[model samples]
Target: MNTRDLQAFVAVVDSGSMVAAAAKLHLTQPGLTRRVQNLETLLGMPLLDRQSKPLKPTAAGRDVYALARNVLVAVDELMAAGAPDSEPSGELRIGVPPFLSELALERPIDRLRDAFPRLTLRVTAGWSPALVQGIERGALDVATVMVPASA
Candidate 1:
């Protein structure tokens, strides 16, 4: 019915309990429960199956939760954009080791998206020596290289 209701429901789904979600939202447990209940009433369907362990969301809840998460993510991006001191924005040229590209790129890329939504990440993948060379030549702003201890 509203962002507040949807936020409470999503928080409950994410936190796995009204008590936990309440703490996360800084609301009383009863208040969070009533917000979720209000959402269910407005939708005319139950969003949560309280009988399930870990408090699984109902099928309808899953659908609404996904949309709510997207809405919240966009809201977060908007808030970040308005807070210049808290927001980081720039272009970063990063040279990554070839193997690490497949092994470790996902999380860092996601973090960059979440933390610096306005920033651009230019990534070049190659062997450590090549990446290091790029960094040394100032072609890359940052590079990660793994080498033998003797080097």
Candidate 2:
């Protein structure tokens, strides 16, 4: 429910054991266990299969893990953007044709970075079809593609 809980969950998932996760989180094993237990209690579902040797995420756990990752990313972005100076500080996913991505977008991207140093720009270059697909899949917030000109 909280960032700490999500962080613990992610640590456990990544480390594949409470002891390992505890070490990585700098918490006692019991403390890490309590946090995971509390999270499961709060969600009314077990996030990890304790019976498993290396710990495996249940189906619900996988879903919660994915959501938690996104939530944490958003929270970090929010904090960065909320800092004084009113500069953008979040991921801006964009897709562009290969040629434009290499040439046209360079100056504009440079200007954007100069204007907002904290911003993280993610640029994906591809042909028109792939760029359109990226946009449709939400992987890209905006896209520029080339098309045949009509005379």
Candidate 3:
């Protein structure tokens, strides 16, 4: 199966309409529809509920959606792994304390951006406990936490 076809199917499901998906992908509606159809044909099942208003995915489609998302993310990471300079790509979710954000993150964040132009940074400022919780829950890729010296 073509990855482009999977991407088109995922985009259509995500955007809830072929028109929006196509617009997001910079392709014509017919082109996007063709891609989805190609995927469906390959899988031998209908992935979409055509009669539904918001373009809900069928049972098989839901499974495909979840798997396709994993596949796409893996593909992106694989590409980044082979990238020159070993520059990281994809989203970096960072959690930091409010004090650190205000006092120390500015220049470091700028440097990170300069170093990894393809990386999308999402920074959240929160308390140490909350930031640590985010890291534990996999909601954050990394976080800084401070503990009392006596503790």
Alpha-carbon runs more than 4 Å astray in model 2: 15-20, 86-125, 142-144
Stronger candidate by TM-score (1 vs 3)? 3
* Residue pairs with clashing backbones, model 3: none
| Residue pairs in candidate 2 whose N, alpha carbon or C atoms collide under 3 angstroms | none
lDDT (10s digit) by residue, model 2, range 73-95: 88987887678666677789988
Better of 1 and 2 by TM-score: 2
- By TM-score, who's the top model here? 3
Identify the runs in model 1 with alpha carbons over 4 angstroms from their true place: 83-85, 88-98, 101-151
- Estimated TM-score for each candidate: 0.58, 0.65, 0.76
lDDT by residue (1-151, candidate 3, tens digit) is: 8999999999999989999999999999999999999999999999999899789999999999999998998999988777766767889999999999868999999999998898999999999999989999999999988989995
Decoy 3 TM-score against native: 0.76
Better of 1 and 2 by lDDT: 2
RMSD of each: 10.3, 4.2, 2.9
For residues 45-139, write the lDDT of model 1, one tens digit per residue: 99999998789899998998998888876776777788868856656789888888767898988899888897888889988899888988988
Residue 151 miss distance in model 3 (angstroms): 5.8
The most accurate candidate by lDDT is 3
